[model samples]
Target: MSNLSQLLKESWVLVEERHDDVAAHFYARMFLTDPGLRQLFPVHLDTQRRCLVEALVTAAASIDDPERFTEYVQGLGRAHRKFHVQPSQFAAFHGALLEALRTVGGDRWTIEYDQAWADALGLLTSNMITGLEQDADPAFWHAEVLAHERRGADIAVLTCQPLQHPLRYQAGQYVSVEVPRYQPRLWRTYSIANAPRPDDTVEFHVRAVGAGWVSSALVRRVRPGDLLRIAAPMGTMVLDRESPRDIVCLAGGVGFAPIKALVDELTRFNRSRWVHVYLGARHRDELYDLDELLRLAATYPWLNVVPCCTDDPSWTGEHGEVSEVLARYGPWHEHDFFVSGSAPMVRASLRTLAELEIPADRIRYDSFGDI
Candidate 1:
């Protein structure tokens, strides 16, 4: 291993057990150093702390692989841009992080360990700065909500029109949305729910999760003519139309957003390749877009839609988790798989597909955090 990787791993091992405390210290020191920076984040620091710990651990573990580590850091940097992260902020964050590590390490810290951490942070932050510089699109787009349809009590489908310039994105990419009501500056990423439209319009499926500030505002407070700011599209879940392989899409709950967009893209070209979709929800009532799926399936003979319910006993439709339901359909060996939903669902689906011998390269997914 390189000196940078070895040092990071060794140092992280000492701090791993007290990661939460370290993260807490890092933020505390950060705000104390620059009090104004505190306003940039949410009031609750628990989730942010967890994210920082996870990121540090992941970076340390992956540091041996230069290409993968660089890609990961670049994506991390791009995601941070949606929050209006500035290049000038990197140094303060780096210093605070190093201080946290030293505070946690106590006598365990040495000059060598400090140098390694500084080097590692320099690499990560430099790449992040490069990522920020690479983006040519506007920081945010102004979109007017054209219509909002409540699919269920907790789900809303928003149709929006960009007010200034067209928002360019692939079939299955997501955009970070900022709603005015919830925590003013907080922005959340939601996958685009349809293929690119001729009118440059976009759709998003927002499901209100418990204590989800932006989602709750989008689904409960957003109305027609309401203006919202959207960051440039992010994510690489888009379909590879060049591939001749058939597709198997596994979607759970609101994870259907990007999967639907991919399927819609395929149907538009009347692609002869067969596409199978396994959409699941906890209750039949939660399968809010069944009609839309059914209509698309009918319109495209090559596409098959299977709806599954995990907890609804009264429903006569296929009953089981989407991954379990997928086992009934044989031979996914030749097909590419797209899995999305809550993190548990995605992890489960990936494990199942791996067991079925589907190559990892052929699977595409967008992690939706804990949703």
Candidate 2:
């Protein structure tokens, strides 16, 4: 790792526990410095605050891996186009971030830490700008909702077709969607639940939680024929087809979206590799996509599907958290692991994988905390 990377990670730890406060401070300084920037964000700053802190942490964690870091920030830059972020605004953001860091660090702050962060931010901004400039694609795609089905009171599955150019994306990637009809200017990310199709259509699984503005609109209010805006796809959790190792996929609740897409893609040419999918939910009613996954498993000889329920005693299949069920089946040292789920579930599964002695490189994951 580079000296700046170590410094960046160490400096971040000082303010990590106070992430919410840090986000609040950063935004306050940013809007104070450039009041016009305030209009770019939502009226409710709760989700935006969490997103800011998550972005900072993700950037810091990936800094030591130049390729991964560049890919991440560049994708972030491209995705930010949906917000109409201008290149000039980056300076104000950087200045506010530095100020926020210094204020949060207090007496522990030093010149070396400031310099390292400045350098890190410089790299982040420059790569993001490059991604922005190199992108010839539209900032957002106009998609028409073709179908919507309520899986339960809180969950829904929807499909949409991009009206103009094809929406090309890898199976496990997700796109930021905006339902302007109901929640204007509020966007949330949803994984494309199916592999790319010739008809330029995509699927999403949504579960409305708490007072999520976008998720509620998507699950309950939005209907077929309504128009939605979709930003460019972003995520690095796609399949590694070249790896000779067998695969184990873990999905919790609606995190099945990406896992289903991956399994779909694998079905195309997977002849030799064994693929096991462990789908988990609190109750059997929550495993909305279990039937479809079972049908797929029955059709493919190499595919195996295990449905796990934590809260349902009537369930005849596996009983336990997905991670716990996975633990019983492991000796997974040689298999590649893909995990997608709620933050807590993902964290638990990762901890289990670490305990099982799985190499870090053999595992890839996507965790949905809020959206």
Candidate 3:
């Protein structure tokens, strides 16, 4: 029997050779045939095409055990439900994906070759559908920009409102963000700053990265009343309320976005649970919601807030990167630790926590891939 891994590797070769280029052509075909789908994507076709290609590449490369891969694909399918993506929509994506495949398959593009590709996509999309059903459609999301305040030199908080009776999402969960100017419906995952329920608006605290398309557009151009495109909120960086352990939340810069929401949820029940938050920034001005955090710290005698600054010329507080500050103060054990931040921040803190012999199972993190 041929190994599924070998078959997938072969599929990847065909996919890799011209995945990007094929994706472009496929979307061109899609737009012509289904202008409706075109409306779903950004004005820039190349960019949208890349995201679809990138999503699939990431999906393909993630396959290790076929059983697990099927499960993951199902999860993606379920996740896309909020997009209101139909079975019909998959046809267009499938055509584009396969057309890209044929071009890359070159001499190996035979009958059996075509069949294998078709079977693979069928399995993948089918699993996606199953996953979607399992999660169920909580409710479709409607996007509204509620407030836009320039918090720092380049960072801003843009609060968004969800549809009435919106689907429930956890803290640290992010949605695919779509801005009109960029093409291909770019996916920038922003943590849900507000907890689920009661309030209908999901907030994202965005920081401009100079070259960042979404963040810059949000800080400089986006207005409170303006409407923007967004996908359904979904992510695993959430607090499992059922898990009744003490929680430690650490954030670096905008990583505070998710952690803040999480703390709110923790406070609702574990009013007496030890919830310690260590938030850091380059300067005091860079701190988002400093007053709010301190207030939480004061109110919950068990919850303490430690704000640190690493780069101010007049530096005081816990002076250093957030991770360094964390290891020094925490020999914290038997607690759930959540860290969300820039790649380096998350990586360094994970190392520090491990070196301190914090159990690997207790730590959770949110990290970005590529840019």
Candidate 4:
């Protein structure tokens, strides 16, 4: 490992527990330094604070892996384009971040740690700026909502037509969406729920969570003819055609969106591949796409659909959490595992797969709901 990478990891531990306070301090310093930048962020800073901490920790954890870190930073850079981030702002943000670190580290802060963090942050910022400059796609795609169907009380399926420059994305990739109803620049991510269609239209499945701004707007307020701005697709959860292993997909709640897209592509091009999909929900009603999945299973003999429901006494189908269900159907060592859902569900699935002796490299995940 590089001296800089090692120093960052070592220093980060000292302030890791104080992340919330650090994030608050960083934002306060940033907005105080440049009040103009305040409008770029939401009034609510809770999610924003958590996102910053999680992103930094994740990047720190990957410092030992240059290739992985580079990809992550580049993708993040491209995504930040939609926020209208500029080169100069990177330095301003770094300054606030350093102050926050120093404030949190206190007695542990050292010249060596400062220098290491400076070098590391400089490199990461440069990569982000370079990625922004090299990105070929527009910051956002203008799309017109062509249709919307409420799957249940909270979930809605939307079909849109990219007004121009339709995004070219893998079946399992997700796009960040911006709704004008909320704060002007407020954006949230929703998985592209289907494979590319002949009409160049894309689909999204949104489930409104309490107090979720974008989800609420998408599920209830947005309608046909409404215009929505969408960021370029970003994610690494797409299929690896090079691998011939059978597939096992674990989806929870509305997490089935991307999995549905993957299944669509697999059924269309790789009909012979054996696939098992375990869809879980709190109850029967939440399995909104069960009928569609069952329809696909009936048409594709190589595909199997298992719906698992918990917290429902009247339910007669598969019962238990997805990981438990996966455990009961043991010996997943040979399958390529794809997991999408709540953070807890994803974490449990990973742990379960690890306990079953599945290699880490064989598992893929995408946990960002609408970040």
What C-alpha lDDT do the candidate models reach, one value each? 0.86, 0.91, 0.73, 0.87
Most TM-score-accurate candidate: 2
lDDT minimum window of 10 residues, candidate 4 = 180-189
Off by over 4 Å in 2: none
Residue 39's lDDT within candidate 3 is 54
Task: State the lDDT of candidate 2 residue by residue for 140-178, as single tens digits.
Answer: 999999999999899999999998889879999999999
- Measured with C-alpha atoms, the lDDT of residue 56 in candidate 3 is 70
TM-score, one value per model: 0.90, 0.98, 0.75, 0.95
Model 3, runs deviating above 4 Å: 1-40, 43-72, 78-85, 88-122, 131-140, 179-187, 354-360, 368-371
Order by lDDT, highest first: 2, 4, 1, 3
- For residues 238-345, could you state the per-residue lDDT of candidate 1 as single tens digits? 888788998899999999999999988887885568999999999988999989999988988899989999898899999999999998887889998889898789
lDDT of 1: 0.86
Candidate 2 vs. true structure, TM-score: 0.98
- Model 4 scores a TM of 0.95
lDDT of 3 by residue, 1-371 (tens): 24444565676776576777777777777677677886565455554565566567656655555775775587577657645677777777776667767776777776666666677777777777677677655524557788888887788888887655564677677766665553235556677787776767777888887566777777788887776666656566777776767788889888898899888777777754688888988898988789988888888788888889988978667888888888787568768899988878898889989888889778878865322
